[model samples]
Target: MARSVRWVTGAKTQWTIHGEQLVDENRHIRLSTADVELPDGTRFTQYVARMPRCAMTLVFNDQQQVLLMYRHRFIIDQWVWELPGGYVDGVEDIAAAAAREVEEETGWRPRSMEHLATFQPAIGSVDQPQQVYLARGADRTDTAPDVNEAEKLDWFTLPEAATMIERGEIVGAATVVAVYRALTLAP
Candidate 1:
C-alpha cells in the first residue's frame, strides 16, 4: 500500500503538450522541440533538453572539512571548486553512483552516504535531475584521481566552503546546495 499526498492543484495554469519532435540525441542528452499550449490558449514550440541523472556528494572528514575538487569547466571556461559527482549510468542506483564518483574523482571512499536532496539545475528548459548525498567521513585510497577529473582535490572547512560560495568560487548548483545543507548539519 502506498500513501497519497495532496498537492495544491491549479488546473487553469497547467500547460498542455501536444507533441515533442526530436531535434537531436546522444548518449548524454536528448534534445527536442515541444508543441505546447499555455493556459491562456497561447501555443508555441519550445526547445527541451533531457539529460541523464547526476549524483554528487558532500564527503566530510573528522576535522569537519569537506572534500572538494578544483577543476576547470570548459563549457563555462572557469576554474571552480565542486563536489565530486557524475552522470548516473543506465539503470545504476543513484547512491552507488555518488559513492563511485567520489572515489573515482577524489580517491576518497565515503564511509556512508545519506541522500541530502534531489533538484533540477535548470527547471525551465532542461530535465536534469541531480541527487545530493552527505557522507560523514571518508578514507583515502592509494588510487589517484582521474587525470581529467580535476586539477586538484582538497578539503575545506565548512566556513571556508561557505566563503568560497560567497566569492562565487563554488558555483555548481549541487555543490552550493550540499554545502549549505552540510553547514546546517555541522556542529
Candidate 2:
C-alpha cells in the first residue's frame, strides 16, 4: 500500500512523487531519478530531466513566408529545418534572446518579436520550457550567419512549412508550433 503524502490532496488520479535524487547536472540540463507512486498503489522510479528555458522565433516577410534554417542536429544525426533559437542566457529576457538567436543563426534581424506561446516540448520526461515568438518582418544584416549554426537559410510559406513538418523535415517542437501559429494568422 502506498502511503498518502500531505502534499497531494484532491485528485485520486494524480501521481505523487515520494522522493527525488539528482543524478547529474550541467549548464544544459539537470537529470534526476524520482520515486513515484501511482493512484493504484503502483510505485516506480523514473528518470526526469530539466533544462534551461529556450526561445525561438518564427520570422516572416511581407510575402507571408517564414524564415528557417537548414541545419544538422548531431544528436539526431539528420539535417532538418528549424526556427532560430537557443537556450535563454542567464537572466536574459526571452524575447530578446529570440531576436538575438534570429540574427546570430540566420543573419536576419527581426523587426519585432511578439510572444506567441510558452510550451513544454516533452512533458513526459523532460522539463524544457520553450517560448515561441512571432516576427512579422526582418532585415538582412551585414554580418554573416554563424557557420556552426546552420548550413543555409531560406523562406517558406506557412503551408509549405506544415507540409515539411508532415514529411519529417521540420522536427523541432518550437518550429512546428510556430508554423501552426503563423498558419492561423495567415490570410
Query: What local lDDT score does residue 152 receive in model 2, on the 0 to 100 scale?
Result: 91
Q: Considering summed lDDT, which 10 consecutive residues are worst modelled in model 1?
A: 6-15
Clashing pairs in 1: none
| TM per candidate | 0.92, 0.91
Cα lDDT tens digits for candidate 2, 56-148 = 999989898999999999999999999999999999999999999999998999999899989998999999999999998999999799999
True-structure RMSD, every candidate: 6.5, 5.2
Model 2 ranges with Cα > 4 A deviation: 1-12
Question: Which pairs of residues clash in candidate 2, taking residues 3 or more apart in a chain or in different chains?
Answer: none
Question: Per-residue lDDT tens digits of candidate 1, residues 49-144?
Answer: 999999999998999789999999999999999999999999999999999999999999999999999999899999999999999889989988
